[model samples]
Target: GAPVTTALDMSQTQALTRAAAVGSAQARAGGDVVPSAPFLIASHGLLGWYWPVSGKLSVLHSGQGIYYGIVPEGDAGGDNAHMPKSLWVVSRPHNVGSNADAKTARRNFLLKVDASPTEDVHVSEGREELAAVPIASVFTHDAYGYANEVLVADTARGDVLRYALDALDGAASGGGRLPEDDEVKDAHVAMHLFTRKDHINTLLAGDSHALALLHSGGPSRAVLFDKECAAQASA
Candidate 1:
């Protein structure tokens, strides 16, 4: 695949979609030499799909009307600055339409996207379904990212969920969501590994590890998880 040298907007997205559609037709007709184009396809409708082309890209969309189609990551230098090294979660706010009811019922959910270091981007197998957790009143702005760790403040649940990137990679193979155990076979439950006070509101990734910030009516504090602590917990 060739590198894209131009900026991509909605217009470009539509054009790419057209091209993919043409290629799909050719493929169905059993034609050889179908033009290969990479896409990070996403759709907000109930029934939408993404092409399984081999490349590094991602698609962000939901049934609530958010669409961020296939796009390359990184800076103009193609350095992948915009890409994620492990999985990252974002609190997504949505109000379907301008209707008063919709506006009044505006809500937020945690959208988790996967990533890897070797590729420009990482996506689930289909890239159609996403790993989402309903977070009614989370600290949307409070998130920490480390090479293989993630911490998110779930104010609604009054606790913080920690994540292990490799575990997520393992889970993605079966589907992007975390497994029923919350802990993958060899990985710990990101949600259960750490415990914090109710309404803990922030997090920051340290230079060598991850730190979670919690706030109560009184003072705010940071909790650092170290190897000894993890080992003790496991034991």
Candidate 2:
């Protein structure tokens, strides 16, 4: 016996027909002047998904690696807590070998984004670059929601590196962009090697502490690190 089609099936058939018609029309239109339904925001390879900030969606390109963290614009408990100020992106070159020089590698970037309530969201061209290949990064902020420090986990080196945001900001004096291959190297405020055998995969930051997730052959483990202890060890 012949199968009977239901209403749902009819609707699905209609949708497919419509989509095919649209596709044909787009092809006939030379792929340039096409229907304006879904707008394209960016064309670069996207690493992270769109992040919501102050009622707008923000996007980061894949050029900044596969990891990123948002910095708040205002105090955590204030009215503007929903707004975002900047994005710290882990910028590692595509297909870079593990043996690449970490000290001279052009990695890590900070991009400033406008999150004002009245204006359209805009990502600034000014970027600050660093010379470390960190797999994961987390931002730590003060009560005012201002990011003071950033902690990065270098999986290849099995180390956690900390850098002061203020110092990086200061390095970019004129146009908020760091010079290319400058003589002054960006210094890490503190660094701690977790384990040589097990590498760190992810890093998370809280008010006064941090967490590192490690990967091993047998079993994975999470380590809680005290900020004070890390600072003392670096000293």
Pick the lDDT winner.
Answer: 2
- lDDT per residue as tens, model 1, 62-157: 454443212122232245455433233443343232222322343443344433223344433323344643432333335455556545554444
Residue by residue across 113-203, what tens digits does model 2's lDDT show? Answer: 3333222453433223322222222321111112587666665556666766665555544444444444224646435555445656666
Check candidate 2 and list the clashing pairs.
Answer: 75-144
Off by over 4 Å in 1: 1-59, 62-87, 90-143, 152-161, 174-186, 189-198, 207-209, 223-227, 230-235
Per-candidate RMSD vs. true structure? 16.5, 16.1
* Top candidate when judged by TM-score against the true structure: 2
Candidate 1 to truth, TM: 0.39
TM-scores, each model vs. reference:
0.39, 0.53
Worst-scoring 10-residue span by lDDT in model 1 = 68-77
